[model samples]
Target: MSGQQQINFEKPFIGSIDQGTSSTRFILFDSKGDTVLSHQIPLKQYHPNPGWVEHDGLEIINSVNECISQVLNKYKETNIGEISDIKAIGITNQRETTIVWDKNTGKPYHNAIVWSDTRTSSIVNRFNTKAESLLKKEQQSQSQQQIVPKDYLRDICGLPIANYFSAVKLRWLIENVPEIDQSNALAGTIDSWLVWNLTNKKTHITDVTNASRTMLMNLATLEWDSKLCDFFDVPNSLLPKICSSAEIYGHVESGPLAGVPIASVLGDQQSAMVGQMCFDKGQAKNTYGTGCFLLYNTGDDIVHSKHGLLTTVCYKLGKDSPVHYALEGSIAVAGAGVKWLIENLGFANNSKEIEALANSVQDTGGMYIVPAFSGLFAPHWRDDARGVMVGLTHHTNKAHIARAMLESTCFQTYEVLKSMEKDSNDKLVELRVDGGMTMNDLLLQIQADILGLPVVRPHNLETTCFGAAYAAGLTVGVWSSAMQFHIGKRFTPNPNIDHMKRINDWHKAVSKSVDWVDK
Candidate 1:
């Protein structure tokens, strides 16, 4: 757990690339789902304008290659034969972070529009206006008709018109960047970019899980919808071919990992769900990363969320297997808000220190930080929302602010969990959690206290990588099923404390955060 462990050449191994918003990591996992070797590089984010975030697409690919090379090189010194032991490589990446590149030269046309970027809010507003106009026109034409209120692409895509999706980002690039034209353009999420690069451009493909997040893929058909594509103005040719989550897409043709089959690709949140072994309906997991994502598995049935949750494909194990569906509540900011407090405000030097600083105070001292930085996601798809700190007083200090920061994630998560229950119609018995934020015991305790449910942490915090590895391992027969991981720790809700008042106050703070920006 502390450092790179020596790998055995005799045993089969799986490599995973976890390309996230904050960092790019390559981890080598043995057949038992234990990390044998790992390397991580922090990614630099560029904020050239307000509410706009971009990442150098080339730099992201370079970080991925560097991580792969470093991890493989370390294994080479310990066991040269182990390089051949790598049976397959899997990928899990930040979903909906849009990237467009030249198909021939292998160069990105512009910086990657990150999932958290709000530059396309104007574009989203345009779409919302168009939808409203169409609905109004229909209502005027038939006053006596029982007009079923048509949800704008919700039935087909399970997403509303929002800046968080890849469609709006792609549209923005096509309209704004002159170089990104139909002649030489190709658009994809971070998963597609990584796979296309890793396979030496032989495979321009994404799995069902990654595709489902695009707001372009049809949830029922599991393919790109032409009508949706035409509506979004993204050419169907620019999109990657959708594939099953567990299949050999291509082989790595360069570097130390040449010829290793690329067998799996999953969105990070869906991968975490798989890594947590939430394969059955009603099972759920919350990933605490740069942002918080809570996914509840609904098996094969696609339940259109009556609540604000998005319905998405969980994973498809095989080409012919029934595709699993899930209801997801994506919180726009969790750890990123924590990072903002640490680096921007100097609340703490390191993220782990926030716990002690926050614990210094008995509570937030009636303070609440609603981190609607890029607007609220999930149940409330309000793009106009912005970050708000309410209930501040003369007695409020940094410790209270720190506690409020951590509690923001808990409160956001609680709202999402409630929405999930409303959609699934089943109470989530316990919450299985993994990711970097799970390392903080105080955060997990807060999660349990807020939700009034037991919080479960896996033996490995890097379950995002493990989930991709599990998919690849399943393809190459490393493991038959995802039954290897065990519970490392559990935090049950405290019955002694009633948190309704605190939660109710947090809701008031969130209300103030919404609609801060008007179109």
Candidate 2:
């Protein structure tokens, strides 16, 4: 369970650049999939307006470089492994976070619009109107009845027309940022940004997993659809070339790890699925980080969610390998909620102290907190929704609120799981989990009790990084196949706790949060 362990200096290692929403990390994994060394740097978030989130693209890339330098220095200090021992590097990044930069200068047009930002709500509304008119025209041509607007491209992209996707974000930037010229600008998610900089701007590419989340790539063809590009009014020239998750896209141009082949790239959640070894159909994993994401592997089949979930690319190991799809339910808030408690509400000094404070109370005193801060994501994609805490009384204290905040994450996760089962038509025997929040034993126990299923955590909670490492290692022959990873902890459902009533109460709180923002 310890990240520091005796190293086999003679073997090859895989380096993973895990660029996430709130931070960036560089981790080196040995042939056994164990963490050899790692370094992390916290990222700065900007909110000039409400419901808006942004990250400085320059700062992000700088932080990434700093992490690489720090980890490399630490690696050399060990005197265990030579720099050349790292045969390949991989990247897993926060998906849907759009960045537009000059193709020639490599300068971002503006701050990277975060995935959680809702500033593009107006753009979504405009697109919905246009889509409805198009649908009506098509129906009239076919001699069919006209209907309300629906997810017109969901069949193609496996995503709804929402502000959560990169297309919408890019549209927002194009409309607002007058200086950007579509022909001279390039747009992509975080993975593309890092890969471009890491290779000294020699490459501009994105893996299938990251491209799928952009709402531009066709789920069936795995390519950027011209029709979609036209619909969003985003130029295809602005996009990065899509590639497989595991391949040598380019090499590190300058660094201690320079000349290393950049072998693999995946969206963070999908990478966790790989790290969890959910290769078979129906296997699922939930990651609790800045947000919570649950992905259910559907093997080669793309199962569209009748319920409110997204069908996305799980992984495409190589150019010739068959594509794997997944049903994903994204929660906008999880660890971020805990963070809000510390930075905004002053609940505790840190997440650990908040857990301690919550344990002081037996329950939330009949309270419920619906963290619809950036609006609800899955099952309820309401951009108008806002955060709400109901069932408060004179007796409610900080302890009660802390418990409610923690319970909110568990409750949201349970809803997503139910939706996943409905879409897949198969029940998950156990839920595999990884992320920073999984370190909180109370939260995991509550997650199990709420779902009435066992929650499993791997000994290495850094599954996000490990997944990238696994794919990169596999590509370079550092590892021949998936290695066995042991489970660290398991929490079974509490037989005595009947959570139905509380779940129902939580639903009521969620309902109260919606429609707070007028159209």
Instruction: Report the number of the highest-TM-score candidate.
Output: 2
lDDT of 2 by residue, 244-315 (tens): 999999999987888999999999999999999988899999999989999999999989888999999999
Lowest lDDT sum, 10 consecutive residues, model 2, at 1-10
TM match of model 1 to true structure? 0.96
- The number of the candidate with the highest lDDT is 2
CA lDDT, candidate 1, residue 464: 90
Off by over 4 Å in 2: 1-10, 143-150
lDDT of 1 by residue, 284-370 (tens): 999998999999999989889888889899999878778999999999888888889888998889988988998888898899999
